[model samples]
Target: MSDDELRELVHRVDLRIERLDARFDALEKRMASVEGRIESLERTMTTRFEGLETRINTKASNWVVSLWGATLAVLIPLLTLWW
Candidate 1:
């Protein structure tokens, strides 16, 4: 190819390279935003699970105590009458 044609080709290639670089930069920014959102979602779900676990544990203990109280209330009276 002539020198002028070669120079034109190089110029077009350089322009294409610049456009590709810009696209890569934009993709990196989008990925960073997505990563931040994922981290926030993870933290929110973790908090919800921890709270649910605490409530379940509290309810289980409360039911156990209530059942024991009720059993005693019924048994003591029956035993006294039998004696």
Candidate 2:
């Protein structure tokens, strides 16, 4: 090919490479944004799960206390009647 044609080809290739680089940079920025969003969602979910667990544990503890109080009340009355 003539020198002029070769130069034109090289210039076209350079422009294509520059466009590809810009696209890659933009894609990297978008990926970072998605990652940040995912991390935020994970933190929110973790906090909600912790709150649910605390509620469940509190309910279970209340049930146990009530059961113990009822048992003692019944047992004490029976013992006094026997004595």
Candidate 3:
């Protein structure tokens, strides 16, 4: 090929590469935004799960207390009557 043709071909390749680079940069920005959104969602879910766990623990404790109180009430009367 002539030197002038080779030079033109190189120029076209450089322009294509520049366009590709700009597209890749835009894609990277979009990916970062998506990652940020995912992280925010994860944090929100974690907070909600923690709140649910706390409620469950509170309910379990209340049930345990009620069961113990009922058992004591029944045993105390039985023991008094027997004595």
- What's each prediction's TM-score? 0.91, 0.86, 0.86
Tens digit of lDDT per residue, candidate 3, span 1-83? 99999999999999999999999999999999999999999999999999999999999999999999999999999999999
CA shift of 16, model 2, Å: 1.2
Error at 79, model 2, angstroms: 1.9
Q: Residue 52: error of model 3 in Å?
A: 1.4
Tens digit of per-residue lDDT, candidate 2, span 1-83: 99999999999999999999999999999999999999999999999999999999999999999999999999999999999
Query: Where does candidate 3 clash, by residue pair?
Result: none
What are the lDDT scores of the predictions, listed in order?
1.00, 1.00, 1.00
Off by over 4 Å in 3: none
Residue 45 error for model 2, in Å? Answer: 1.4
Model 1 stretches astray by more than 4 angstroms? none
Clash counts for all predictions? 0, 0, 0
